[model samples]
Target: MKRDSCQQRIYAVRRVGLAIDRAARATSKIDKRQAARWATAWGVACGVRQF
Candidate 1:
């Protein structure tokens, strides 16, 4: 039981890490429109107006 729980935890962590890695890789390939949207959201969150 303990070993099974440990294995499950490791699997979950690996899945989350892989998702983060994919997101980082995808962000690097973002086009201007997506980048603009991200920038706008970030600016709004930071209380700045993004043109």
Candidate 2:
């Protein structure tokens, strides 16, 4: 008789929501977008799995 092993995979999700004050937060919006872009780029460069 033989035994087999299996691997499990997990994923992380980020949910961004919009608000009514969105019209007054231009700088904040830009900053958030820049951060997200950098993070994804860095992850890809480092071979990080993102969902």
Tens-digit lDDT string for candidate 1 (14-51): 55455445555564555544545554554443444435
| Collision count of model 1 | 0
Task: Give the candidate number with the greatest lDDT.
Answer: 1
TM-score of each: 0.45, 0.42
Write the residue-wise lDDT of candidate 2 on 1-51 in tens digits.
542321111111111112212323546777667656655554443345356
Clashing pairs in 1: none
